[model samples]
Target: MLIDEVPERAVRRAGAAIELPEGLLVLDADSGEFGRMPKPVADAKIRGLSFDGARMVLVGGRGTCLLRLADGEQCWYGIPEERYDEHADLSPDGRTIAILTCDEENAIISLLDPETGRRRDIWSDPGTASHECEIRWSPAGRTIAATYMIWDDEMDDDALSTVVVDAADGRVLAGPFIRTHLLGGWLTADLLSFREEYDDLHRLQRLDTTTGEVITGPTIPGRVWAAVAGRHVHEVDELEDHHAEDTTFYTTDIGFADRRPLFTLQPKVEVRYFFLAAGVSLPPSR
Candidate 1:
């Protein structure tokens, strides 16, 4: 269902949520009913949803807050004095939260404790700025993959890079890999899928974080809008008719086999921001 004037949306394994101008429209997976939950903080933006759809992270003009869907319980992060343009992701185990924040000079990734409202910076890179600054936690919750737009003073342009770090102590495990963008969640604890420009076409590729091995996957037929759960690839294709377009959201294995079409959007709408709960099965589109 396309919602007019909705600015943001997030999809989980069991349901989905839309950010309306008034409030958050939540689709309850268990009841198969829709409900509206007032934003915990005024003008807060939905950063991410937990795997089970029980909790969500929101960032607002004030700070970031964690909302419990069961009772609307709220836990605000301790860093209210810091930047407001932060992005957050809840760990799979529901114990830790990853927060990505950046300023004009540096990019920072930190871990937060929901219960105690404590935060610790895990990694910080000076002289680099973030583009999307999206972070994804591995299935085991042991590592994080982050996207950044690094400024290249020599090239006089910004370059895309993906960095993988240890979730525990902020050790660099794999990258600051240049010119690669993370495709989806981790396929495994060590494997990540990404895309790189190859002869003017965007081609899917896989990286083994442990061994520094790279493997080229299938060539994408159209532009890949998003990838989720390391298996489903959301693609947008311009139709032959100029006035309309088609957006195909499908799921496939790591090898791009056993392809399945989950849903398609005709006369495509511009999706400015959308996120899928990583490592979770998306309920079949109804």
Candidate 2:
């Protein structure tokens, strides 16, 4: 390994990611602390990972994990700690995990108790409703926000809709509403932000979980961002075709392409950088 030309021998499977001897690492420049992500859960590629103070959820293609981590490394489970691993959505309180599992014949959402690994069928799809992304806990920890709908098969995007389930009993509280994006947010502790069509463009709208009300926010092309704190360190990926072509012969609007402000994006390549949010260095994949 080379830390600015200081050479050192690196062992096999100990670098920066799995499957290729590479592992993920975390760095907090403000605190001057840096470390690699603990080897993937049981060495499985993490399809999704999120931490919200009390709970840590790791979602993968083969399996999933529900555990509480202290200081990002310590595993805190008083029980046997083996059965809570499943493809599930972790509740904000770290108590319940809502998993949509199916057999060759049926598909249902199973409300799972991570501590005991006990599960109960909360909801079932009569048609062909399968789960999609954005399965998460509301900031208040009372509602489970997820998306599911009928489609052709595994790779098809059709009839995508959002549902807010009651975490306690798995009751459908609100929505089966049409949504174009599998995107939602906890804009506030009680507000759940979702995307919907607003006129000719898509907009971000917040739903008040308590009052069944709605409030619209900014519009986006596909995605947008806002900085809560700290600053982001970025690397540009400009297209070779991007040059002094003020008259590039296009009948469309300008965007975050070559000459963009937020960040430069290129086709067929990923631009991974560092997002120093509140101290944690978030991995940006190119």
Candidate 3:
């Protein structure tokens, strides 16, 4: 009897900070799929996400955590007093990290030097608080676009709005645009993105940071996740809404907004795995 040779396939280790429709789950993008990151720590309700194209930084509840894929490591960092976590983003060059902090009484923006783990108090607003939905920086890192929602206990409504802040002086440059969220925006020399409700199903809208004019995308259904730039094929899994305890992980597309069902990913069947090679050392940040 004789055996034939079979080629070996390489496995990639990956982890994802999944923003589920109802809850958030940090699952092993490779394997160990069912093992969910604890609910409370996962912050079932994540306001925003920022990826420097390498590590991912997650901000929610009262803390911010940094996660890496190659080694499967996580680091938790807390904000200063009177400053509750809201949303965060990385600077264009990826040297500094900015976070919005709210206290119920007012809102402020702070910047952290990731290399040194040092934070600087940048801007503060006494009259209002920031909307927790989204916060982003422009390509130059000179301006910030923040969505601000107003909470009215009497009317029982969350009114939508946005503000453009000058990073240098912390001054409101544009507005307080009223009644909007779920924006697909970008920061060039100019800032552009569409602002719309979940039901409106807005396409990518380009915005002018100086004039506040918008160029809209084609109308579509459902909410927009992230923007895709090129022709890279992606597998998506549209998972049904799940409660914190019952569900493990669901399927979704990588390029979901394109309206192209190009690929399908089954979490269990199609997966990746990471194993420690003998004598390999883990870094202190992990």
Identify the candidate with maximal lDDT: 1
Question: TM-scores across all candidates?
Answer: 0.80, 0.57, 0.60
Screening candidate 1 with a backbone cut-off below 3 angstroms (N, C-alpha, C), the clashing residue pairs are none
- Please give the lDDT score at residue 175 for candidate 2: 74
TM-score of 2: 0.57
Candidate 1 lDDT, 48-107, residue by residue in tens: 778777777777655667777666678776553545446778898889988777666777
For TM-score, the strongest prediction is 1
Task: Report the lDDT of model 1 for residue 12.
Answer: 31
Worst lDDT 10-window in candidate 3: 277-286
Model 1 whole-model lDDT (C-alpha atoms): 0.66
User: Which residue runs does candidate 2 get wrong by more than 4 Å?
Assistant: 1-39, 42-56, 60-62, 67-87, 104-107, 127-132, 152-157, 197-200, 221-286
Order of candidate numbers by lDDT, starting with the best: 1, 3, 2
For the record, the alpha-carbon RMSD of candidate 1 to the native fold, in angstroms, is: 4.2
Candidate 2: global Cα-lDDT? 0.43
lDDT (tens digit, per residue) of candidate 3 on 44-88: 133333333334556666466655534446566677776677677
The models' CA-based lDDT, in order, is 0.66, 0.43, 0.48
